[model samples]
Target: MILELVRFLVFIFFVITSFMIILLVLFQDEQGDGIGGVFGGGSSSIFGARSSSVAIKITAFFITLFLFL
Candidate 1:
């Protein structure tokens, strides 16, 4: 029973992480001047400079989590 419960929890976590990764990928800017630019494209804007890096890292994290699960 304990093993089955653990498996089910892992499955849930995997599914959640998969969805998060997909969303992060979609939100990421393409060619450094895509959808992400529309919000704060200016170089002076902190988000414009850092969003891509943040998104990429988060996406990678979720992908790794999904794989581990």
Candidate 2:
């Protein structure tokens, strides 16, 4: 039952994240501006635009999680 709950929560999280990703993509500027254009791109971007370690880490975590499930 606990495993099932985790799976269900993960499913909801994925669904919500998918929509958020789509919205963020749509908000980005096509020329060169990122979501930072709408938010703040130049001032606070710790990682560069393309090579974010955070993105890699999050992706790795999700992949491992999915596999474990």
Candidate 3:
């Protein structure tokens, strides 16, 4: 039963992460800056720059984990 619950949670996590990654990738420009410069162009840096750093890493880690799973 515990293993089954773990499997279910992992499945949900994987699906959610995949959806978010797809959304992020789809919304990004070919240059790979992501939907940043579209409207926040005036800023010296891109949107979600600093905070996105960690978020991106975490997303990447999850993606890798999902792939391995």
Candidate 4:
């Protein structure tokens, strides 16, 4: 019973993390006219210069969590 509960929780966590990663990737700016274009321009990053790095780290973390789960 506990094992099934754990499995269900893990599945939910994975789906939530997957969605978050997708949204995070979509929010990041590329060269030009990317997701940022939807809001405005890429003249400045909302998270500053290290935004891409931060996003990459977060994505990696989500992937790692899936592997462990």
Sorted by TM-score, highest first, which candidate order results?
1, 4, 3, 2
lDDT of 2 by residue, 1-69 (tens): 999999999898877666655554455434454556324464324344653435433444454454564
Candidate numbers sorted by lDDT from highest down: 1, 4, 3, 2
Angstrom error at residue 6, model 1: 0.5
TM value for model 4: 0.55
After superposition on all C-alphas, the RMSD of every candidate to the true structure, in Å, is 6.9, 8.3, 7.4, 7.4
For candidate 2, the TM-score is 0.47
Location of the lowest summed lDDT over 10 successive residues in candidate 3? 42-51
**Winner on TM-score (2 vs 3):** 3
Task: For candidate 4, give the lDDT of residue 58.
Answer: 72
lDDT of each: 0.67, 0.53, 0.59, 0.64
Each candidate structure's TM-score, on Cα atoms with residue i matched to residue i, is: 0.64, 0.47, 0.49, 0.55
Candidate with top TM-score is 1
Off by over 4 Å in 1: 32-52
What would you estimate as the lDDT of candidate 1? 0.67
> Residues 33-56, candidate 1, lDDT per residue (tens digit)?
554453565332333445436665
Local accuracy of candidate 3 as per-residue lDDT tens digits, 1-69: 999999999899878878877876555435444546434542323334543344444556656776886
User: Which one wins on lDDT?
Assistant: 1
